[model samples]
Target: MRIKKYSFLLLALLAISFKSFSQDTTQYIVANRKNSLAQQNKPYVILISADGFRYDFAKRYNAQNLLRLGSEGISTPYMMPSYPSVTFPNHYAIVSGLYPSHSGLVNNTYYDRARKDKYLMSNKAKVADSSWYGGAPLWVRAEQQNMLSASFYWVASEAAIQGVRPTYYYIYNEKIDMHNRIAAVVNWLKLPPSQRPHLITFYLPQVDHAAHLNGPESPEAEKEVHFVDSAVNELQKVVKTTRLKNVNFVFVSDHGMTKVDNKNPIGIPAAIDTSKFVISGDGILVELYAKNKGDIQATYNELKKEAKDYDVYLKSNVPARLHYGTADDWHNHIGDILLIPRAPKVFNLWNNKKINPGWHGYDPTVVPDMRASFTAWGPAFKKHLVVTPFENVSVFNLISEILGLKHTDKIDGTNQLANKVLIKKASKKK
Candidate 1:
């Protein structure tokens, strides 16, 4: 009997010891997680792109939250998008820090010579194919450095570029409402320290879509501006409620929009046969690919003479300021002759009778309508900082710096431009 009692007592002692060890292990894990989070010192960087948002729209409309962000954070007079200034190229450029020329996404749709394939944005297979996208995107860079990243609806996030994707991403779905998008990001931010993303990208296309359908000055565009602003305000509220630490917000646009007057459309000149050249792009920028390489010069001469409201140039002779054809592989896909229309005018290659009311894709340098907006607010940025106009390419470096991630050496953006908005840490006196 005594032996039986002693055995039970021994078993009970073993159970108590195991329970204590398990508790200790759990506490150790919790402590380590806290320490790990504390050691990370890096801020959560939120990149928000409002497509087709013109720089002047902010001033014209009463975007309360947007204006408040500008007043509280670093605001630039404008951000000049890379040439072509289209959606896909500029969005990719903002993330990759490379010009569209070098990035191999010179236009929204282009032929890949090596692959002998055409890429169209509307084509789901082409859009998701990683081969169509070049240059290391910010998400890939973040993951490579062992940091988690997420994308709500950013371009190229759908593609598994370089066999890497953001730690969490959703395929582009336009049907998803604005509230859901903002809520999804907020939820990601609320994850445990180990699972939360360091970098998050959100895309709001309502303003751009409205701007494209209705002119920038129209009530439709104005309503979208307010809608997007409210969405941003909600995001700020969610973050504030969650009490997230060291979070930064970057607001930008891929490009702007311009009103296209259908009453006076610039039609393709009759002197040049449009059938002979493979035409790509729309609106202000047109790429004419010579069917026969030998006929390139003749084509250029004809285009120059025929085009009244536009300037025509060979790929090699495109203006240095535009930086359109600097890439080595430009000849593979770039048009033999480029056509750019003067501002407030767009090329009408299609003979459709229906009036297209609004458009963009203009030369950003001379066209004020093509300029995009940029604002940065967070712990990392200087308060009420107003910076000189800078190019959108610099955004990549700014994001990399904010996330404490290293960018590839081939990038065109310099750190000097991004430093203008960053808070200067006080130096210790010698």
Candidate 2:
């Protein structure tokens, strides 16, 4: 009887110890997961692009939210866009940290020699095709480092570049109401810590579209400006309700708009033979690809005759300031000769002409209308800071720094150049 009792006691003790050990192990795992979640929830960086919002538009219309952001954080008088100051090229430059030359998106619509394909922004398939895009966008860099990212209509965000995309992305839909877009972004911010995205990008096109239809200074454009401002106000309210910590906000524009009078259209010089080249781009910037490589010199000579009206140059002779021409093994998609019409002088390629009221794609240096808006407000930036005018390419580096992500070395932006706007520079040391 004594032996049996001793055996029973030993069995009971072993069972109790085993149960305690199992409970401890489970608690340890749960604790580790919680810590992991906290780590992943680091600070949030939200990049917003208000297409065609000129630098002066905010001050002109007394945009309350934009003015508040400018006073509270960092604001630049204007952000210079890359050459061919248009939509796709500049937007991609802002995200990829590369010039249009390096990103391979020289124009909104261009012909790719390798695939024998033409890429058009209107063509959804081509827009989503990874091959048409080059360089690492901000979202791609975030995902490669095991960080979460999301986008709501950001340029190039819809494409699965390098076979990877943001954790959450929606297809480009123009009909989606602006309020819905803002609500969706706010919802992403409200996700549980573990599911939250560290980086998010949202695009608002109403301002740009309005500016396109009506001149930038028109009342129609002002209404659209107020519309975007209201959306920003809603975003600010939603963000406060979440009580989220360490969030940064960046607002930018691809390029501004310039008035183009349809009644005063300038026709292409008859000296230039249309049959000798394949032309791409339709507005202020015209790209002419010679049918034969040998004809490049002859094409340049012919176009040079009318040099007073347009700045004409061969690909090799393109101004160094433009920073165009392909990098790496990518084909040179820019035309053999580029014809940039002087501002207020619009290009009318068609023999039959009609009026196009507004346009961009002008030389950013000379034309103030081509300068875009840039404002950043957050814990990462210095309060009431007014920075000198800088190019949009530096924006990519600024965003990467804010998100604490590693950027590809092939980028043209320098961290030092973009760091001028930040409050805590040493925070990015790691």
**Count of backbone clashes, every candidate in sequence:** 0, 0
Poorly placed runs, candidate 2 (over 4 Å): 1-39, 325-330, 350-353, 425-430
lDDT of 1: 0.74
Error of 2 at 298 (Å): 1.6
lDDT score for candidate 2 against the true structure: 0.74
Q: 135-172 in candidate 2: lDDT tens per residue?
A: 98988887777777888767777688998778788776
What are the per-residue Cα lDDT tens digits for candidate 1 across 1-430? 0122332232222110001111111100111112144324567889999888899788889888988899998898899999788888899999998888878888776666556566666556677788877788998887777777888767788788998778777766665667777778888788777777888899888887777667788999999999888888898778887687578899999888888765676876654555566566665677767667787888788777777778888888888777776344443667777888877777655543344577777788878888999988988788998888888988998888777777646887878756787765311100
Clashes of 1: 0
TM-score for all models, in order of appearance = 0.87, 0.87
By TM-score, how accurate is candidate 2?
A: 0.87
What lDDT score belongs to each candidate, Candidate 1 first? Answer: 0.74, 0.74
